[model samples]
Target: MSEVREYIAHARSVVIKIGSSALTDLADGLDKARLDRLADAIEARMRAGSDVIVVSSGAIGAGIAPLGLKKRPTDLATKQAAASVGQLALAHAWGTSFARYDRTVGQVLLTADDISNRAHHANAQRTLDRLRSLGAVAVVNENDTVATNEIRFGDNDRLAALVAHLAGADALVLLSDVDGLYDGDPRKVSETGERARFIPEVSGPEDLDGVIAGSGGALGTGGMASKLAAARLSADAGVPVLLASAEQAGQALADASVGTVFAARPERLSARKFWVRHAADARGQIVLDDGAVAAVSRRRRSLLAAGVVGVEGRFSDGDVVELVDTTGRIHARGVVAFDSDDISSMMGAHSEELPADLARPVIHADDLVPL
Candidate 1:
């Protein structure tokens, strides 16, 4: 507990993710009072000399009442329409709330492409850095208005985790409906007649075994499973995470003992490696022979064409692909150096035996991230 408090005290920057269940309702839309309270809490953190970024989820839910929809739309197109309308209202509400304290808020909407593509990812990092430097709280959300199913983040919880890495945050606070993680579903009593127990900390993946993740609320897409996934993602990147109820936003931000804290891993992956391992969408798969698997996964060597067994899916040079063993287990993710067709033709041939243009590594070690 002392260590957790120390970690929170030393965190210079943090990302706060507020879910839809905490921000809106199916019929009432955005809750002005709740937004104000949250804004006030964020402002307090800023006044305390810590940089803060908010990854908010409520665009579609906030649009429900305005669009006369009785519930969340199941179709992609209608959901996108609602997001477009609600995005404006959501941003305005945030802007208006922060205005009370004379704090400026900047809205940043992102699609999956924005975070996965190298160039776009760099651009986003620059924008976020500049916003922080200028003392503005960046309000980020998934760009559901224009995102297709293929490029959507699916939920803001995942987006927040990715953003924590992108923004180089020291901590991430996930504000949801539940107070914290529990050993069992908090809504039900166990056969032993005992209620679920609140977990103060999660040290590793093993802590989650046997834990039941309850379903999400009517207005939110993410349940406990998504929150845990997000926490692990950020924790792996060396950012600690706190999961708490929205009602306790102030305590959570203050690093009080009010939520579950996920410990950060000691070894942090490089930004590029982390991106490849978690963010880049695999466009294809390169199946390797046994020898190739050992070399790439164990020795961390560049993938050579001599041990290539097969190629699955069509992908261009420089696209992200999965490096898998012949048995279909993925060993790594890498940026391939050749087109799928070219790789197909070069497989099983040594580099020295190939033409000068095709003699290089199929995937450079620097571009590979072992899973």
Candidate 2:
């Protein structure tokens, strides 16, 4: 059907995430040849007028053996240190591989903090967009060295989804060790068994429940479940996802039905709503007056100084917050213009009665990514 080709033929921008198992050797170091093949495939796609951003996972895995460790380190500090060393190695490998096609490569390392904060998210997107515009491939990875437990991407699968949303990517390809999602753990079942059937549609989380093929292998951080979750997120953003083996990278890009393709939702969320509902985590809440609620919920206008009634929790400017009406039901999620304390003071004050300096928006419509 045209629906399948529709995504592939029109995917001007895409996010391709390769797992550690695809990029490195569990026993030794980076797999340069496989890396080269992947880069070549990306180059091929670029030649076809697609802007590709690569989210890779291999830093800690590549650093494992060289640091005299037997396997992935358990201690956070050691893992961070190893990632610092391995990141250089990983970047260099990608750079060298990409250069073979006479193409330039740019390295981008991001943490969860980058997307959680509005400013950092904007800057990160701008940088990646600029790099792609300059005819360079932007190779991204998690900032494992500086990322702590609370701020780390946790796994690159989720990072790829966030990047897809940030880059406005049309599709997200998650390449892993397995071919695709199966009915059960394919590794435990015979190849000719019922589990070999590829799943074509996953309507909801229930469709994926107990459908894991395998957990994360020794070298990778993500398992089959994480990839499925990433697919769901991307699909919800109106961007379909492809879960396939790294070996089928080229075919997947060509839109071949060689793997599982998670269908996108028929309806797409508005950009701001998508950002607020999916990308940014809510930090606080702002209760609005009846008129203000009507303006935002129905008219979709910016929140002004007049409508605020109450504030809950501490939040900074540009942080996403829940917008609740008088009855205590959340009407939307938006960014707050003023901090919690400032909003508390601005509450119930009309624009004309407020001090000249305090008359600005309590929550700017543009700043608010309404959910």
Candidate 3:
């Protein structure tokens, strides 16, 4: 526990994610008071020399009241409409709250493509890095208005975990309505009327064996399950995670023992590799022979066309693809150098036997991440 606190205390860069339930009221719209309080906590961290990036989720919830909606929208079109209306209000609230501390908050909205596409991923990283270098706080959120159902992140908790890696954060803090994770739903009493057990620390998946995650709140998309998943993702990426209530933001940011802290994994993957393994959306699949799987996953070699037995989906060159074995087990993921049709034609042909134009490695080792 002390080690976790120390890790958080010394973190130079942090990503704090505030959930929709923490930042909005179902009856009202954006909660200015809550936003201001969160800004105060974030500003304090910045003032203490820790760079902070906020991944907030409240655009749709904030739009509910203004759009004359009695409840959270269920339909994609209605949700998008709410997000469109709420984003402005959400941004303005953040901007106004941070202005109190003479801090500048830059709004950065992104869709799933921004993280999955290599070029867009690089651009987003550069933009967030530049914002931090300029001493401005980046208030990030999913581009809800323009994001379709197919491309949505589904929940900001997952988005926040990915953002932590994208921003090169040292720590991640997830603030929501619940104070912390428990062995059971803390809101519910047991049959014997006993309170749920609070889990103060989670070192790995084994610790979550019997834990129960309740459904999401009326105004939010993510529940405790999503938070745990996000925490594990960030922790595995070498970023310590703290899950606490928004009301305890100050204490949590101060490294106080007020939340459930997820210890960071000892082994860390490079940002690019981690992105490839977890964030990049696989557009297609390339089925490889047993020899190919061994060469790629065991020997850590580049994928050769001769080893490919089949190609699936209509992916273009330079798109992310899964390298699977004959039995459908994914061995690796990489950016294919050829289009699906091109690969299909080149399958089972040795490099030397192929035309000069098609002789190169199918997926270079540098672009491949072993799963």
Candidate 4:
């Protein structure tokens, strides 16, 4: 067995993500008892000197009762309306709970733009870092009030994973209603009437093939599949993750192997790469031929106009764009060097024949990330 306690013993920074189902009572909403339990555990871990950042989800669930809604709203406008009201209640519960232990909690709400835009991404990172520096527990949540369905992070799990990378956390704990991933749906009784087999650890993608994840809860958007996706994403960024029940928050935060654990990658990705891989939103795509695809993926070469056969979307220079092959497979994502108009005219042209300024590669190797 892996020594879970030992790993937590050495971790300098940790991220604890509490799901909406964990924090709210479906009927009553904003369950203080559960929130208190979570806060107490997190405060203990934070007091021990590890920088702790929390990605919490509960606003919409908490809003249900106060708004007199029968269930979670399905429409974007109603959902946003609930978020605007419930966020305050959710923050209060967290703040008051932490206050009991003399720890301050800061609420930082983020929209997709906060993580997808280059400048906003950095600013968000700096804000969280500063919050940790001041010995305050930073409580983060999606800005559901203003986010559109097209751009919103559908689940907090993905947001938590991205935040773990942005905050440079060593470990991530996803506290949910379910304890861990299982070979079969735990809720479904087997022919022998036995619970599904538990999956203690997942080394990589192949281990997840047989695992079937269920849908999201009535109170939240994330389910087992989303948590697994989040875990893998964080792992790729070199942050190990624990998927455990909220009841096991204390054990999970202490690094005990209470739930499924996904191992981190051998090497950590650079901050820029992590952003490019997880957070950057591509504004357009540049379709490349077979040769161009091989050049970028195998040879690690910059994308030049000569290799470009077509472009999609209208974007200015410095915007993030995708490099795709004739098959429409995205080979890489990078910041375009030329405006869409300039690139359109430059396509299929030799490098030397182009104007001196336009001679530069359309997407430099340093700016490109092979998917």
Taken over the whole model, the C-alpha lDDT of each candidate is 0.91, 0.83, 0.91, 0.88
After superposition, candidate 2 runs with Cα above 4 Å error: 189-197, 203-215, 285-312, 316-318, 322-332, 336-371
Q: Give per-candidate clash totals.
A: 0, 1, 0, 0
Which candidate achieves the best TM-score against the true structure? 1
- TM-score, prediction 1: 0.96
Q: Please write out the lDDT profile of model 3 over residues 1-371, one tens digit for every residue.
A: 57987788668999999999888988988889888898998988888889999999999999999999999999989999999999999999998998887888899999999998878999999999999999998999999999998998878999999999998898999999999999998878999999889999898889888998876889998999899988988888888899999999999998647889999989777977897788989999999999999999999999999999999899999888999999999989998899999999999999999999999999999989887
Sort the predicted structures by TM-score, highest score first: 1, 4, 3, 2
Between candidates 2 and 3, name the one with more favorable lDDT: 3
Off by over 4 Å in 1: none
lDDT tens digits by residue: candidate 4, 135-195: 8999999999999998898899999999999899988889999988898788889888887
Candidate 2 per-residue C-alpha lDDT over 247-327 given as tens digits, one digit per residue, 9 for 90 to 100: 998887776467777878887666666778777777988999889998888887889867888888999887889999878
Q: What is the lDDT of residue 359 in candidate 4?
A: 93
Per residue, candidate 1 scores C-alpha lDDT tens digits across 143-238 of 989998889887888999999999999888899899999987888998999999888888888888878876667888899989988899999898
Better of 1 and 2 by TM-score: 1
Q: What TM value does model 3 have?
A: 0.91
Error in Å for residue 350 of model 3: 4.9
Report the error of model 2 at residue 289, Å: 15
